[model samples]
Target: MTTLLALSDDFGSQLGKGIGAIALYAIVGLVLVLLGFYAIDWTTPGKLSDLVRTGKPNAVVVTSAGLISMAFIIVVAINNSDSDLTAGLITALVYGLVGIVVQVLAIRILEWATRIDIGTLIQSETYSPASLVVAAAHLALGLIIAVSIS
Candidate 1:
């Protein structure tokens, strides 16, 4: 009975630690996603949340793509992190921030290389081909970063 009690306590402690790690990772992921959103918003003409509220398809597509890209990076970071909790959290945070910067740079590069007015394109009420292209680019960037880190 004493052995069983010890095992139970150990299991409970490990479970608690796992839960705490998950919560920390989740918070980091959310912050990264928000940063990605703001980065997209900064590149565009208007507030992304406002455009989302107004139900603009272009805005919706770009916003969704950006958030999804952030998620990809965060997921990959978490998956590839060290087993130690503190080390894992630090690794995820650094990777996530780097992912955001890479994504923003990709967007700027796309705009510069293609001569597409991304800000004007995203403001369109109707879906634009530019939006699709940008969305694809964002996803590709995410995958590329995720793979590189892994």
Candidate 2:
């Protein structure tokens, strides 16, 4: 029937749109994560990727925490975004950037308040207590930013 054909077309179109949205969000999320990683790298002494490749536990822990925090912000941004695709993408992007900035600020605050150089701590070969504290600060600030977006 023509009605059935039309229904199928409509469904297919909607499916395509949904897939497109997913791809867009995925790309955006990846970019945000990379940005967060670079932000951490910039604040630290050596390259984060190089440290990670050398099997440094402190570097790995700090990097993992930063990435996870970024993911939390992106997830919340996507969840709370507008129903409209363009609007939603814009909202997510803005919130994600804001989350990154806030996270960096949080790290700085922790370093100042605790009088521990997080960058130097993360460069250590062995895991340190300062690494744990930095990781916790990153996660807590990320959650706070994500919740504020919602």
Candidate 3:
């Protein structure tokens, strides 16, 4: 009994530092995602004008999907922890929703100002598959963030 208690105590003592390290890794992962977003924004073939005119980009879809996934994983993973689950979940959801709305709204407003038909572009076969995949992945990430992190 004494040995078991001692072992547990030793493990507990080191747990905080280990967990903090893991949190750091998560932050790093987030930064990488952000960086990737920026990279695509600058390097992609389609012009911002094109996206605005059409209000449709596979990039938006891919990122949205990834974020959705993240929200779910983060929320569900942390529910039973000592963390303030409510605050975390709320913040993640709000951030994701705001991001999605902003992207969509920007596209819509731009298309409106340019007098372009967004619906037509969306229905076109020239839509990007790769960018859409990225958007889907982000949405999945967002879902994980919503459900698991809390």
Candidate 4:
């Protein structure tokens, strides 16, 4: 009975530590994802949030794709990380932010090379097929980053 009690106490303490680590990582991850959202919003023309609020499908597609891409990169970074909780969170943040930047740059480069006004397409009230191209670019870039991190 005494041995069981001691084991329970040890387990409780370890559980507390694990919970704390998870909370810290979660908060950091959320912030990084928000940052990514803002970055993508800035790269594109018009207010993405406003468009989404008004039920624009093109805006929804771009924003949803960006969020998913950001989340995927962060998840991969967290999984591949083996450092202490804080260090791992920082590493994930770096990977996430860099992924966002690269994704934005890739879109801009594509816009220039292909002569497609990706920004205009994203902002259009009509459902633009070009929006899918932009969304796919982000997803492809995100997959590349996620694989590189892992």
Candidate 5:
């Protein structure tokens, strides 16, 4: 138990160093998801804006795809390593979950900065900066994990 705690602490510190960059990466991924919705909205049957407004398939589809893709990529990246995959994968799962919380905070900041109520801009091509910030943080974390293990 002590060994496990020590290892986790060591790893967490390394990850914490790159938290900002990781958030940026997460935000980028979020933006991509939003963009997917934009494309689907234009090409699909119903109005994308309406679906997002109602929080229907639009929100579900976009968020799910982004998360699923992130999970797969993270898991694969971690698992393929010769080093500690469990630690890496678990760290990513936890870290990514926390980043969502970070994004919630980012949303408020973005609202203040841009004066564009994020709720209203849900389905549009224009995504708020919150998503970008979160993605940057994620990108940083992912790089750290990938490099640390390698």
Candidate 6:
């Protein structure tokens, strides 16, 4: 009976620490995701949120893809970070932001390589297959960065 009580106490303590760490990581991840949204918005020609809200197909695709990429970064960071929650939180933030920056830069580089203005493409009200390409690029970049974090 005493042994069982001790085990239960240990489990409770561990659960508390786990919850605290999750909270800290979640807050950091949210801030980073918001930053990613603004960064992506800055890159496009028009207001991404406005376009997405208005049912612009291209904008919807781009915005959703950007969000998924940012989420991938955060998940990888949280999973692979060191045991220290404080340090892990910092690592997650850094990885998330860096991953976002790199993905944006990749888009710009693709623009130069293809001699196409991705921003202009995204801003158009008409649906463009290029949006799918951009979305794939974002995911590819996210995956590459996430693996590196591990």
Model 3 TM: 0.35
Which residue runs does candidate 6 get wrong by more than 4 Å? Answer: 1-6
Which of candidates 3 and 6 reaches a greater TM-score? 6
Q: What stretches of model 3 exceed 4 Å from their correct place?
A: 1-7, 45-150
Q: Sorted on lDDT, highest at the top, how do the candidates line up?
A: 2, 1, 6, 4, 3, 5
Residue 107 lDDT in candidate 4:
62
TM, every model: 0.89, 0.89, 0.35, 0.86, 0.32, 0.87
The TM-score, computed over Cα atoms with residue i paired to residue i, of candidate 1 is: 0.89
Which tens-of-lDDT digit does each residue in 1-150 have in candidate 6? 355434664898899999998788889888988998898889777888988888888889978988898788779977877789888887888878888888778766765776667668766889999888888877877777778778
lDDT of each residue in 17-102, candidate 3, tens digit only: 66774575465446534543444344334543355456565434543454445434433433423345345445544454444444
lDDT of each: 0.83, 0.84, 0.46, 0.79, 0.45, 0.82
Pairwise lDDT winner, candidates 1 and 6:
1
Per-residue lDDT, model 1, residue 121, is 75
Best by lDDT: 2
Models ranked on TM-score:
2, 1, 6, 4, 3, 5
Q: Point out the worst 10-residue segment of candidate 6 by lDDT.
A: 1-10
Per-residue lDDT tens digits of candidate 2, residues 32-59? Answer: 8889889878877788899899988988
Report the number of backbone clashes for model 2: 0
Q: What ranges in model 4 sit over 4 Å off?
A: 1-9
Model 1: per-residue Cα lDDT over 1-150, one tens digit each: 355434664898889998998899889888888887888788767888898899989889988888898788889988998899899989988988888888788877976888878778777878887888888888888888888879
